[model samples]
Target: MVYRQEIMLTGAGGQGLILASIILADAAVQDDKNVVQTQSYGPEARGGESMAGVILDIDPIYYPRITSPTVLLSMNQQSFNKYIKRAGENCLVIVDSTFVEDVGNQPAYSYPITARTRLELEKEIVANIVALSIVNTMADLVSRQALQESVLKYTPEGSSDLNLQALELGRQLTHSYD
Candidate 1:
């Protein structure tokens, strides 16, 4: 089977979701997959809406835009409300339960992403990495080693251990859901 995915990651601008998308795209490339990534954010740059879209396929991807995402990850309530409507009916929805209280009857995998990052990893900034790890584990999107390499490559110096712990915590959280 040809591997293909249209992934949308949404949240506020300061949430680091764009970086997460880049990491995911790089991991896909590391796995020898063709991938394209794009992003947009509001003027406020921090609290304003932000979204990143990534398309991955074994075959060539002619278009980079995501009209109907196969996977949707929303980090906040506003993003969840805005982008969830654009998702396909069969889209796999993942929400950060710490920020999104209402999933509106959608079959969403709710995780305490920011809360876990703060409580477990002691740094909420790595919540994006945790969320990426959760999405990767749940979707089986890429090799764990590739993802780890990408994470280490993209993250800042001296924070590798925390990010790695965040990744493991995310995987453990997904398993706990099952």
Candidate 2:
């Protein structure tokens, strides 16, 4: 597999973009690869725009920021518009269809990520984990075992099961092709 892949995840503060990025970065670390994780969050972390960038490669990563991303995931409408413009032809863009009514003209995979996490999974904070699960499945950049292990490693003492469930649920969402 190609090792150098830049992932740009953007969303509202409460949407879990940073958490998802951290999960992806840690998974890369576990794979014995070079990885860099960074974030851009607004003043209102709860409601404001938030983004996390993860770059992983066989070679050491020098800069933390993404120059060009291979994947772009945006939750809120604002973030979708902001980052959609940055996407190239081959980029995979994931949007939370719950809040992002308009996908613009970018290359994307529009999904009701938040809605599925809330209504289907019956969880709130678990949405980010759910979203990351879809990303991992779609890209194949991060292995399934690596991501699951990352969740097991860093999840809070009691929430490991929920996180794993969320990941499984999210993975299921992608296969249905909805």
- Give the whole-model CA lDDT for all candidates, comma-separated: 0.94, 0.86
lDDT of 2: 0.86
lDDT of 2 by residue, 51-129 (tens): 8999988987898899888898888899888887778888888887888898756657878888888887687789888
Q: Pick the candidate with the highest lDDT.
A: 1
Model 1 poorest 10 in a row by lDDT: 40-49
Give each prediction's root-mean-square deviation over alpha carbons: 1.0, 1.6
Candidate 1: segments with Cα more than 4 A from true spot? none
lDDT by residue for model 1 (1-178), tens: 9567999999999999999999999999999999999998877857999999999998999978998899999999999999988988889999999999999888999999999889987889999999999999999889999999999999999999999999999999998776
Q: Estimate the lDDT of model 1.
A: 0.94
Q: How many residue pairs clash per model?
A: 0, 0
